[model samples]
Target: MFKQKKQQELREICKSRGVSLTPQRQAVMRALAARRDHPTADQLYEDLCRQMPGMSRTTVYRVLETFEKLGLVRKVDSRASKAHYDADTTLHPHLVCLNCGKVVDYQDREFGHLEPPVFTDDGFQIVDYAVTLVGFCRQCRQDPNN
Candidate 1:
């Protein structure tokens, strides 16, 4: 039920933005929406390749780029070298595991209430922001070796 509603919302958003909702685009959106792990383009490509055998890695990259530009997705920076994509565009925090390279969503009212620092003195206009807390995850903490 949620997926269907999201699909409709996506279609409406695309229409408003004059973006074409191609089959490939929809497939990519669904793939991102289905996972909250903030997967990289290659990860998404790998998963979709089994179903879309002919889909190229370049196409996946391009689709994700388009989605990011359309504000349908967010490109999150992680400890990993590659950038990860998030389908949820809402303003929220992320908990990144330094050891396992895992990314998890984090929500804190106090953090959300904090105001953005003033940077106008430096001629920087803060349009938006995101907070990411980095630390060891439960699995890593349990391992004595780590």
Candidate 2:
């Protein structure tokens, strides 16, 4: 969860984007930001429903998509059947557990040793690329190995 100051800053961002700080949207953002577990839209909605009564599952899903476009959040890649919401904006790779399907962050000096590959675009610009590293988390390696 972000500090009060960061929450206020997020609110300001919404205002500047001309996006209303509706109760539903606010609740959804708060829930996602409060958690680092990288929850799916449905999971997020379940949490929001408890805090903000009458919150629609669809609203939670749509609001998240809007915030993603506004750069307030990101979709964390996972082996799970659904997408996950991530508030961290730092550039880093992820290690996905095959057994429990957990997502772990990874940053290595080796990654910095090589320059990123580049390709010319016909017209559109390429801003950036995310490097996702897939592997088993320590928790998944315990006991019987899969």
Candidate 3:
């Protein structure tokens, strides 16, 4: 149901923006929405390759970039070198595992509420923000090797 809603939202957004809702774009959106865990472009491409035999990694990367620009998805911040993506665009906290590079939404949305001024003393605008709490996940903490 969540994936379906996101897909529909994508359609509406593309229509309003005068962008073509390409099959590759829809597939990328669906794949991202379907996963609960934040995944890198490579991970998404791997999953998509199975469903879309001829899909290329470059295509997935490009599609994700477009989605991010369209505000249909968000690029999550993590310690990992690779970029992680989240389908949910709402401002919220995330729990990032330093050991395994796992990124999960912090269940409590009110944990790090902030009200920043529109412009700083230097005239730098505050358009967006992210709150990420770093720590080892339950599994990583339990496993000695992790």
Candidate 4:
């Protein structure tokens, strides 16, 4: 969807969730959707501030957490300490670059078919999962010059 439509939908989502749709929240979503870097709250705050010179870091982090809680975005933690937000909310997996830490979504039937073994064995609820394939991207794998 276009930014205007997506922004309107995001506003509606926030309203439904009882979150006040302040311009800071709107700008956070816009900054995320505008790029594919999987930026953190700090990165978002920097960008948001460039446009909205008065935006706060705390608000950016809070809005992103709110978005995740509403299922408007996916939160992936490729490691223990950091969380990455994904805009595409669908059945998919991740191809993560170990060198630069870029995450790209990879969707396939093979991945879709793998049910959580624990669900059947121990009767645990399986909501969703990200089947990760970690490796270096082409740019990271290639030498700068021949």
Instruction: Estimate the Cα RMSD of every predicted model relative to the unseen true structure.
Output: 2.3, 3.1, 1.1, 3.1
Q: Judged by lDDT relative to the true structure, which candidate is superior, 2 or 4?
A: 4
Please list the residue runs of candidate 4 whose C-alpha ends up more than 4 Å from where it truly belongs after superposition: 107-119, 144-146
lDDT of 3: 0.94
- C-alpha TM-scores of all predictions: 0.85, 0.80, 0.94, 0.80
Top lDDT model: 3
Ranking by TM-score: 3, 1, 4, 2
Query: Which digits, one per residue and each the tens of the lDDT, describe model 2 over residues 1-146?
Result: 37454467569988898888887777777787788777889888888888887888888889889888988777876767888778776566776776777775665735624354465556555566666667667666675464
Each candidate's number of clashing pairs is 0, 0, 0, 0
TM-score of structure candidate 1: 0.85
Against the reference, the lDDT scores of all candidates come to 0.84, 0.74, 0.94, 0.74
Clash pairs detected, candidate 4: none
Global lDDT for candidate 1?
0.84
Residue 113, candidate 3: how far off, in angstroms?
A: 1.8
Candidate 3: 10-residue stretch with minimal lDDT: 137-146
lDDT of 1 at 25: 84
Model 3 agreement with the true structure over 29-124: per-residue lDDT tens digits? 999999989999999999999999989999999999999998999999897899999999989899999989999999999898798899999999
Screening candidate 2 with a backbone cut-off below 3 angstroms (N, C-alpha, C), the clashing residue pairs are none
Among these predicted structures, which one has the highest TM-score? 3
Task: Count backbone clashes in candidate 1.
Answer: 0
- Candidate 1 segments whose C-alpha is farther than 4 A from its true place: 109-113, 117-123, 144-146
lDDT, candidate 4, equals: 0.74
